[model samples]
Target: MKKERAKVEEVSTTEEKYAQWKSQVPVLYDWFANHNLVWPSLSCRWGPQIEQAVYKNKHRLYLSEQTDGSLPNTLIVANCEVVKSRVAAAEHIEHFNEEARSPFVKKYKTILHPGEVNRIRELPQNSKIVATHTDSPDVLIWDIEAQPNRHAVLGASVSRPDLILTGHQDNAEFALAMCPTEPFVLSGGKDKSVVLWSIQDHISISAAADQGSTKSPGSGSSSVKQDSKVGGDSTTMSPSIGPRGIYQGHRNTVEDVQFCPTSVQEFCSVGDDSCLILWDARVGFNPVIKVEKAHDADIHCVDWNHHDENLILTGSADNSVHMFDRRNLTSGGAGSPIHKFKGHSDAVLCVQWCPDKSSVFGSAAEDGLLNIWDHEKAWKAKERIGTRTRSTSPGLFFQHGGHRGKVIEFHWNPSDPWTIISVSDDCDTIGGGGTLQIWRMNDMIYRPKEEVLAELEQFKSHLNTCK
Candidate 1:
């Protein structure tokens, strides 16, 4: 038994045996060179060893291997152990904990659920009152007053939503927009309908429901007083309180709808029919202005310029963004777009006019790129954000790679101009499957002028050292 164990120990290890076999085989260096097939120096441990190798061309090659053999007479692509440096290891571990696990990522404040959030918008001048429309028919009103430290406390403080608005017939509501001045909310869904909801009425009903549950059964005076206080007026409290208005004219699914920043009564709706219909809430279903064939393909989003209401921005599946002038929609006028911005590699999904700057606006596309364009610069983008892979411009000031999937919707924080809230289909959090990511301008690549200059200098120094 001792002699047999010694003989077994004498047998070469897998790496040693592979090295000896490689030395005995004739190297195919000339064949690899002729076909431009260069063997990578970086090694891999577990793969089929080549029993026979033939190079046809740069794009085509032939190989044959045996399941069981003393290793083949081919290039040994050894698996290399990528030992990370101390700094790299720390970064890897930090990224793993932040992305793979929960409680470490600090950017997300609260996780809203029940369904995937389709659209999120804050009430005008009220950052705390966030209205989120989901795949579900109901719209969830979140009161983000308490900021939780741990991931577990994310949706804990936010008990039931402040209010739930439900009027859509379809299962999913795709678009949502809160009135800037009024106590109204507008939502459009796959049902090809737009429903306007009253915020005050919803709140009053919720308050009354809560009060009724808490009041004692026999306490007549107390219950009556509470009912009167919560319900306000009997006329105001309608038993069948529903949507204020339900507008239906779109032949296809309403992709996006937005209220004119200047006129509360007037709003624009775009759908899969490739039409832009301008509607007045007071006029019922009749559209004030309807522009047919808004684009070659389905229109995804539309935004009214905050400064110039006449200027309307529309993004389409045709991979182009058009700037339309409402004034020039006549029989004998400049029929085409005033200016067309075409840089996105894929269909444009969302567009928004800058809250602070009038000339500047941002557009998000299916290619996972956010482009900022200034009207003054015509078609040239002022700055590009998100990814650099498909962008045509070289001046990408800030690139965000946090979202693993397509970023469908993003909104600039009204209160904090530097902060941006974006939602994605694929989120990194374990518990919160699809999450809302809050990005701060300071935290991104947007650096100070001095810092940028310092980085340039450092890069130049490194290049000189390499030379």
Candidate 2:
């Protein structure tokens, strides 16, 4: 039994080493050879062994095989230990008892229902090169660049028969709003400035949906609320903002900028500092809320809530995720995170809440695992989430092993409430196809479907009486 356990643990450890090295240097040839490590691809027939990564709250825990391997990713996967799972988000509370897990190994949640993991083949015509991913759901846009490759993929439309929108820039990473104040939109990028243009004025619109994890929205309001009375028929392609105003705050490259789904006028930014500044397109420089020490590591991504105004999610390099309360700033560091999600074994790449619900969010790490948690659950049982430093025991609802490369990005779908899509440029996570995958909420993690269903029905009946 020890040998069996040792073998599995060996795999987990080797792969882990590889992950650490690969994060900076894409290739693992030289690093692995120096460490006297055998390549899984060369030594084994089934290709490099895949390990499991679990994101406990915002951090990650990667279970590599039990070995003193050098490269983090190459350590073969080790024992599958379940840690704290499903910590929910509670209201206006910072300290909770949910256990904290490492970010490296966010156990891969099984997919009882594989979602539509299809790459778009019929891309919109006149599509330019790619720049970055956007959040305007349904449509993805691209940068119509005179120069290509530096940064393309401006954005994308979500559906077929799509309409593309893009930012006209040479080398700047401009902020291209699908819909901003009135029919006008704002384009802010690396040029260190913002340009306002009419949605139709550019005639050069590209197809886009701006796939991103926004937490909340005022129905159809655009970032930096423009005119209240817009269009009723603006389906997926409808413009978001009205009027035209450039938002300038950051002195350096703007790492991320997101509009509060709750109020169009509300926006936020985190970049080049230990600063997370909340903004209102209406006013510049003075952020509504400014947070310092947002993360010990660089803050990579932030998402607004879909319903609650006081709630927002952030992913950082310190290898953790945090829930920030916007509405209330407390003396007990009241505004401090209602909870700090620590589980990523490596730097967390991105985080997003389900478009349909704020409580449901997904986080990805450099270690290559995607994690889904009930924000509410993590908040309520915050103490029971991950392995406590004193004890290394796992919690329930955790995936043991999944993915073969650095999980770059994953997003929850709005149109199909239960669907999720993840894309990885990782060279190692899944051996070969480290390809994009689509997943749906399933009973794979929740076994005994009948039993779970019975529980849900019972709960529903109980709720009905209260209603």
Candidate 3:
């Protein structure tokens, strides 16, 4: 046993108080190690850097969200990390007026969902409770002194979700990113930039948010969409998309992003500027690897094929989605999307592929409509079997996700690919004041997978017969 000793210079009282105040540091674990304390910290554990503070438990986490001159959102216990599944433990919405002054919490809340736990650990350093609790929303004004009982408390209505990914300035629409390498959520706001969060080892760290009798008013749900794919090849597919790396190298705000379904790292992005960038996660700044005078107008959405990592698809505000190949850029051929999905009347908001159906991706527009892009018939090659001569058309159930508002975001559930999760606001088609809606695919809907496979098979047989 290594003997760990505390350099205690003070025994007690007067002169010792000055000595202890200056010298007293913190330790992690205290044991009978020759009668002393020991603190353990990571020398260099291979993990992502921590960019922001996060309160967390094993199964959940909470984030502090702040914006200029406006109330912000806080998470109770939110986990969207692909690998580890944490529910949430504690959370708080922090508002700092003056540091040393008695900091009052306008929104101190705690959540204990089933399978979630609340805990705290003792650190030998200067300690403060990271999480807290309140009886109701009006604890400060309602007088915590008068109403001692929490049974009658209620939280004022506001949709404080479990995660806050992006921060904002003056409420402008800021873009945010998720660091797949780090479990933290990144955000950007009024500054027109980005912020990253680190939340891996906050377990048992004191959380400020605590459960209360107050019913949170106007609480609603916000969701993040991860993966979308077009079904292809009539073969078994990998459940997850890959060659995963942060796709960077944009000079402006990235308008749309998509993963290459067939090639894990092969993906594409279009910027607010008229530029298209292609990348492989394993590769770097060279991701300006592919470029095109993609659109005169700003680019809107980018998508990739389930079977071809080289096949890149894009949609733009210019009312067009173009396909390009990796070889076309390298070989200098007249390479572009084999066909353009040219039916939408307004700017396209989102695009995704039906994971179960080949050559199918869904597109949403400002016009409050969803279009199913079926590429099976879009391609017209002399030979069609496993060939890139595939074509695209409208899908059968491309309509409102039961919402009558303008869709801002559309996501396909990974577990159930046909399920579309769309967020729309009051003016569009999301009927009532733009709520997030979950729409189910029609069971009676039809997909021509078997037919496409049969056609490709016959084409292959013809080639074989000729050879």
Best by TM-score: 1
lDDT of 1 by residue, 444-465 (tens): 1333468878877998999999
The segments of candidate 2 whose C-alpha lies over 4 angstroms from its true place after superposition are 1-243, 329-334, 383-401, 428-434, 444-467
Displacement of residue 286 (Cα, Å) in model 2 is: 3.9
Backbone steric clashes in candidate 1, count? 5
Across 324-358, the per-residue lDDT of candidate 2 in tens digits comes to 88766532322577777766677777677766655
lDDT (tens digit, per residue) of candidate 3 on 321-402: 6666666674222345556677666777666566667567777766555666666554532235444433433222344423
Summed over model 3, clashes come to 61
State the lDDT at 293 in candidate 1: 80
Please, what is the TM-score per model?
0.56, 0.50, 0.45
lDDT of 1 at 104: 16
Give Cα-based local distance difference scores for all models. Answer: 0.52, 0.42, 0.37
